[model samples]
Target: MTPPSAPPPPADGLLAAGRRNLRALAHAVSHPSHPPTPLFADAPKRWQRLLPYVVVVALVATFLPLTITVLTDYGMSGGLAGAIAAVQTVPLLMIAHRPLQAWWIILPADVVGGLFALGGPASQSSWPWTPSVIVAYLFLMLALALRETRQTLIGVWLVTGAAGAVLGRLFPGESDGTNVLLLVLSAVVLVIGGALRERGEAQRRLVEQETISEAERAHRTLLEERTRIARELHDVVAHHMSVITVQADSAPYRVGGLPPEAQAEFASIAASARESLTEMRRLLSVLRSEDATGERAPQPGLDRLQQLVEATVRAGVPAGLSLTAGLAEPGRLPQTIDLSAYRIVQEALANVVRHAPGADTRVSVSSDGTDLTVLVVNGPPAGPASPVEAGGAGGHGLVGMRERVRLTGGTLDTGPLPDGGFRVAARLPLGTKEPVSP
Candidate 1:
């Protein structure tokens, strides 16, 4: 059997730990890329008037004992002693703006003090890996990690490691200062710093993405509302324009002979109105073509309710309409309310034609001064539904009715009735409006 291996050196544990940390850092960035000195991880807050000053005082305090030891034991001049103190504290002061660069400043300052300014490397860990320099680097790394990106963090870790490795070899200390173990410990700290930086970046990106998604969703909703308004405009305006064209064309015949110029002007108005109506219908078809059959038809309103009911009746459903609350009166309804009422009626009737075919359907409209109420009811179906039922709008008819009532600041109720029929009703509030003649 092979002889038992010698126990590993003490520094080997530090090396292993550092490598494990470096691996963890790599994994963190491979996937993606808090609080305080309470955690040894917070950057000083610059907004507080005394935070920077406090940091300077605290860093100076830490180095004070070391500074005196360097002065008395090394016999360094007073000016040189002050210079070493400055190297340790100034970087800590400047850490917020230029943390990585501050780290660079502290590292070489420690080297210079170790080699030339202070006494010989006689007492402890020599030149590069001295205690003072280690403290400076730790503080600086903690600050820099909060600000730097993953790539910059890797560069920082490498630079610090390489510098320590080279110096350790050149001026080896009593405690193996020039050894790879110093580089390992440095790697561990810097890797942890880099991991922290990446996490911060990832969280910032998540918040930004959420904000963008919210804005995009709002924009999309606005565009959809605009499109629906345009469709309603087409349906309502085209009907009025067609009526205007007919009235203009028939005015001379209905009233009496007119002057030649007046007749020509009326003809011009009729032609223009007909052209506009044609274009509106075309646009509506393009925007809302419901079937591949490609049938293009005029939009219907209350004026066309009789024709619509006749068609529904012919399609095997008996349908009728009742009107009250001055809604039955012609020519005084607000155009917006008229259009909404028509569309609501159309959608409810369509639902009946599809879902409850062969069922008797009744649509009733009643209004108090402030609100118009619409109700559509259908008897239970007599038999299996036709293909129209299978291919008809899925749940979208109710959705459209709800939106229409919502636009009017209204309430809608729809459900099965106790009598084995379905009921759809809406109470739409009418705001004050200047009435338009029919």
Candidate 2:
């Protein structure tokens, strides 16, 4: 057997960790941070439109004061003082878009500016960290805290403290306590900024989740309405199949002297029809559960429209009805078309009642011998909306209406009016063929 490999030295482990940290620091210093919100986004519209000019003027105003302070108080040369002030203030403009890069520039400039101030007159005592430099750096730190990760923020704070410590040890000036003060203030700023950023992110995520949930609910409601329509249409097709089966089975008995071949054909037709009915019954069972016994009532037709409008009037909406001559006669239209028309009108009125409450509404049915038109229009709400309306138009009223019109091979148009109201119009063909079973 080969000898076992010895364990690596502890220093080697330390060295590897050090290299990894160096790489992380390099990455953190290079990449841009999150975009910051505009400083005056919530200002009045006219002011917001001129924000670019306002921001530029504000930055120049800030630069002028800092440059004057460094030149007059510290007794530094005018060119050097202006250069240092430019480096400190110019990066403030970039901090919103590129916090890390701005921090990299401003930190070194601050250290160099402070070092240069050390050569000034013995009377000036703001050495290692001037008041102007401290204020500027704190602003940058707050911006970084809002955009950068916690680890990056810690690294920035530590590096700042380390630079201050190195400068203090090398120079040993009277203003040595300024370094400690800046660090403490920056720590507080970082904490507050981080909390604000986290709150904004949480609110954004909540709004997005609500939007997705609403869309999913609407889709689910559409699927459920389709299932219900299929069950009703299944009943219509099943009725016709049963009638065919009965007629075919009685053909030979009702006629006299029928041939053997003819009798056999009639018997085969009845058998096939009965088999189809059996399959449909099985499908109907699957469509609704065993507990759906209350749904077995006969489907409504256009003849019930008058009763529906009357009931709606009794419920407090001022509604009217119009029916074309002979249009409400029984058997005037195919069973599928008649039922779909009634359902569409019913759903439209329900939406009006739920959404527009006390609005003036009209229900009209007319025919020009080929196609039938059903219209329901409502004016603006005359009273405050109900609590249910305040929550949302959460029901599948429009979805069910569209699905009914589609199955009957008709056209529907629905939209809001210019006067804060709504309209629903459906045109169903009077000669529509009976719908085939799915």
Candidate 3:
């Protein structure tokens, strides 16, 4: 059988340290090691809206070089003609960078540039700029579709198409059916891709939120279970120890006026019982949750066998406790070993108080390399007064101690001693121990 595992340390220190470090890192990141303010925060939306206008200006700029070439051939001064053409390209550059607000500036610039191209002394027709316009429009729409949702891309496409149709009507161009169909198909692809991206992002976020919620619920359930177990342990120890305390305190007074040696023995028993009560109280104090501010102390471990023996003594039982090795070096003993050892001793002493009052008891604890051994023996009840209430009442103390020992992969033997008393002995393996049956 496997030995019982050790209990976990209290969570307060580790959890607090983790939270402190996380908070510090969050504060440091928010402030940054070196801070810089970002620019153009509001520029993207404006740029999206002005994209079509920017495309129109770019198309106009593309036709300028050819127009200027013909104008110079017809006797226009080369330097003067080049200056006029250069002016038309300005709006295109500005609109490309600041699309939304560029319309107010570019619309007037477009009319002047258009007049110059159409009415110059060396003017020539370069009317159909459809291919350049279509390419620029497609590029802008593709960018918007990749960055935004379907609805926004659709709005942009509709606006650009309507404006383009109006310009085409005013300045007639040759267009084949296939070119128009390709343009429409490209626009449809942009809208579909944008819609899918938005849908996928939404679904991913929903799944993440659900996962977080489930984890939080599991954490709360674990906390509740821990609290419930703590409460049960507290209740069990308090009830049984309280009974032992009453019986121990009343024993000396009940058997009055005995021989000096007998009286001294009874007094020693009372003192031992008081000490046990004190240690039990100390153990209970440690078990109290940290939320309480009272001065209650922490519980005892296997290190306090003397105190246990003293308590047994106060209960009118003569207890001789011998320890070959103190708990100073638990070595590889698991937490279960420590807890079970403490509990087994506590239960054994309580049994002496209840079922073997005024009897001589011997408590011994020794470790042989890998196994811990505990033996508690008591001579029969001192008087005919039946030390225990009899029946099943005297059985449970031994059963409980055995069960605790077994959980640590130990063996327990409890039965009548040849000398007319009872003895309980347990051997708990330091490694790979299994639970003992009651």
Highest TM-score among the candidates is held by which one? 2
lDDT of each: 0.68, 0.81, 0.58
lDDT of 1 by residue, 1-438 (tens): 999999867898889998987786655433322212222233455346556557755876777667656544565767777777677666676665556556667767766665653334365434445556566566676666666565556656666676666665665543254435546665677678778767877887999999999789666655555457568777667768888999999999997869999999999999999889888878867766475343256444456666777888888888887877456456656666666777787778888777777888998888777877888899987767667567643434665676666666678899998777899988777776332321
Residue-level lDDT tens digits of model 3 in 1-438 = 999999886799889987986665444323322112221233468775665556556665675575456445435578855664455344344433343233334333433333344433423333222233334334444434444444444444454455445544665532223234434965776777567656766886998998998788656554544443344455445545566666656666777766778766656766776676677667656655667553245344576678878977887888888887555354334545665677677777787677667888888888886988888888987855453455424434554665566557788888897878988888888876445442
Which has the higher TM-score value, candidate number 2 or candidate number 3?
2
TM-scores of the candidates in the order shown: 0.56, 0.84, 0.34
Clashing pairs in 2: none
Error of 1 at 364 (Å): 18
Give the Cα-based TM-score of candidate 1 against the true structure: 0.56
> How do all the candidates rank in terms of lDDT, highest first?
2, 1, 3
Give the per-residue lDDT digits (tens) of candidate 2, residues 39-87.
4344578777466446545764786577557655787877778888888
Whole-model lDDT, model 3: 0.58
Superposition error at 357 for model 2 (Å): 3.2
Q: Candidate 2: count the clashes.
A: 0
Model 2, runs deviating above 4 Å: 1-30, 33-57, 289-291, 379-382, 417-421, 432-438
* Model 1 steric clash total: 2
Stretches of candidate 1 off by over 4 Å are 1-57, 70-79, 117-127, 172-175, 252-263, 285-330, 340-438
